[model samples]
Target: MSAENEVRQFIVAADDDGIRLDRWFKRHLEDVSFNIVSRWARTGQLRVDGARATPGDRLVQGQTIRVPPAEPVKPDTVKVKPDRPPLSDDQIAFMREMVIHQDASAIVLNKPPGLATQGGTKTHEHIDGLLDALQFDLEGRPKLVHRLDKDTSGALLIARTSRAAAFFSKSFSGRTAKKIYWALVMGVPEIEDGIIDLPLAKQPGTGGEKMHVDEKEGAPSRTRYRVIEAAGNKTAWVELQPFTGRTHQLRVHMAAIGHPIVGDGKYGLQEAFLTGGISRKMHLHARRIRIDHPDGGKLDATAELPSHFAESMKTLGFDLSLGDWIPLDDGPVPPTREQKKAMGRAHAKSVRKERRGERGRRRG
Candidate 1:
């Protein structure tokens, strides 16, 4: 083996206790796999103190372990040709800065708008799909923790191991994680603080791929909004706290209030669409996120306003450069749990019904 491929072994210590053997190795081995670990146990590729060990076995307070090098697999590196589409050095720096936080547990990123969180047939270098392409220690590949919309740029989280991934996966699916968004709306509301209780369903298009919002039979969505800036009848800066994390909850709710974001082609004003609306960019920005950190303390991360959003603010006459909002007033408190459950449930029902009607019309 070359010096690079030479295996490094270590003794399991007190710090490694409580975590599974597979997980411990995920932080140590290059290209670690749960399936491979399982096979190793059956075939004796792995040994604890020079003996076979099970996948679920946890290391004791002080345990001797033998981590033999993983059997050879496929080519380890992504062979990007020297002539692959040349990227500016600045662009590469931007990519690295996206990964905001990382530990043995997870990796966080500041995802830019207009980029898919993952890759598809039309997708190129999206976040999740490109995790392996990212620079990493000689340990394991990165994984995605959650998804942000294509046009919604902000704090995106990823996992480096399955154990770390499970925590976030459950947090998002169970509505424990909170995501905050900022949007420039067309007008201010009468109520300074209120909840947008709406249900959101995916409206399928002719191609049966792309997604739109429908009210028929959709998922429950709840958004709590507070006005941060009021720019007369032309526009307003608002912070949206999504309670349920439904698809396009903030956008749909703002549209429902007759204040679609400036550049939202989907739920935006038709005039804006005709006249290069919202400056040809979506106004929604994922601004902040709060989650319980696995190690300790709360994970409160924020993504600054991108240039497009700043330009939109200036174009809308919000005055000054980015983040120069003069607070006209502070809105109300966050939605209560009772409010979220009730409103979210109702919204989901309504969306589902609207989607069903839309489907019927398409069929007819």
Candidate 2:
């Protein structure tokens, strides 16, 4: 065996106590790729406190992690890439202009439409790339805690530190964060206020880019929408609150009820367009976001509408003052696991009672 063939051991620190084993590797062993870590776990070479552990296993403080010897690098295995080009003055100015709110731990941007939150294939100019300019006074670049669609505009939050990122991520996952969205739908709903309680699954053949209502096999999704104003039954301005963070939940829920957001051709088809010079861009905007601050208190921010959206509202003659103050409801809350189990038992009991009643009626 080579000199480097000896195993290495690490003790989990308090800061990394609850982090996954793979994440610990990334933080400390930057040269150790994820694939190597997975292979070590699969071959029983990776362990925590003398027990075979997976990459996803959470580490506890003072736990010993046994790691196999570093794999030797092969010829042409490592690729050296150039560093990112420095941001131009214009780019830095634009990114700074997007900031609507900033605190020690968080920064909120009034992200405009057409700029993606993160880059994908063929997408080069994105908010993620511009985050470097927002890193003012911070050693690390701010991290995105949530996302908004490329066509949707409005309040997007960024965490200035890793601790803030973890805190904001937990707040969103716990559903304690409140997000209010505004959208102009194709038609006015008969009910001014209602909840869309449909289950959603990715539409087959769309490559998971589109969502549709699925009854038998789908994740539970719920959205509460209230019509703020209507223009002669042709269109309505609505406020949307999603209880579950499904992909495109607000867009899918609105479309499923036959009132797709204006200009959403993917889901609404030709009917998504309006003829009265309304902007062809998607009309959904995240109007406001409120969440618990990492330090204390609450961080609440409101983003102004994009120019196109503001113009459309002016054309519709809907007062801007009326838009932001709509009373929010308690909204749809997901059932807890214990509540679901109790409901299941109650449903089975009802079924048994009905069966017994059927037998009694036959005897009569």
**Highest TM-score model number:** 2
Model 2 gets an lDDT of 0.90
Q: Give the least accurate 10-residue stretch of model 1, judged by summed lDDT.
A: 321-330
lDDT of 2 at 197: 86
Error of 2 at 4 (Å): 5.7
Clashes of each: 17, 0
**1-364: candidate 2 lDDT, tens digit per residue:** 7758989999987656567899889878877889999999999999999999999998787999999998887758775657878999999999999999998899999999999999998899999998999989978888999999999999999999766776788899988899999999998999998878888999999988889998878888888899899988899999998888999899999999999999899899999999979989999999999999988999999999999999999999887787877754544485744467999999999999999999999999
lDDT by candidate, in order shown: 0.70, 0.90
Q: Could you tell me every candidate's TM-score relative to the true structure? A: 0.62, 0.83
The lDDT, on a scale of 0 to 1, for candidate 1 is: 0.70
Worst 10 residues of 2 by lDDT: 329-338
The alpha-carbon RMSD values of the candidates against the true structure, listed in the order shown, are 11.7, 4.2
In model 1, how large is the Cα lDDT of residue 205? 52
